[model samples]
Target: MEVHTVSETPPDRPPQSGLVRALKVPRNAVIGIGFGIALAVVAYLARVLELLGPFAGTREYPVLGPEGWFLVLAFVLATSTALLVASVLTVVEIVRLARTVDE
Candidate 1:
């Protein structure tokens, strides 16, 4: 029988926790699929609400104007970028997990 104890000393291969664990999700392809999906969903909603680029100028439209479009685009881009990066990290984590020696 063998027992492994948790200690402050890091393992030769560090154990994952928190966000690291989240990134290790095996399902993500890490090719920006989630980012693309989320962006599409958001864009669809914005268009449906008549809140896209055409209405982005707040001063011109007083509602859903240029500012609105800029805000929406900025938000969508930022969120998609973050998700894409996270997805890539998840891919790396999955690969690392695959290579780890299992007890």
Candidate 2:
């Protein structure tokens, strides 16, 4: 039987591959993504408000006519899609980073 004690195990910080190091995300990129997500949320709220607020009282969404509503919906979809993509990328990057650790 073999038992690996904590003291015997390698440190959590391990050498990273050249490709991984090259691809490592910068802090600014993460912050940018967060800001993007926040922007998306704000847009979503604005869209909902427009739909349910004063604009909605005019001739069944006159402010946002059929075409205009379509555009807003598209914006919402785009933001949500961006959020999803960012989240997935972040998770994948985290996993990749974790794999580099000795633990």
Error of 1 at 84 (Å): 0.9
lDDT (Cα, tens digit) per residue for candidate 1, span 1-103: 9999889876586456554555655445344556665666676567656675555543554578755665667577756776776667777776776677462
lDDT of 2 by residue, 1-103 (tens): 9996668767777567554445554543565466666666665666656654644344565786755775677567666665666556667877777788847
Off by more than 4 A, model 2 = 1-61
Clashes of each: 8, 0
CA lDDT scores, all candidates in order: 0.63, 0.62
Candidate 2 local Cα displacement, residue 39, angstroms: 18
Worst 10 residues of 1 by lDDT: 24-33
Error of 2 at 76 (Å): 0.6
Best by lDDT: 1
> Model 1 off-target regions past 4 Å?
1-62
The worst-scoring run of ten residues by lDDT in candidate 2 lies at: 19-28
Model 2 has an lDDT value of 0.62
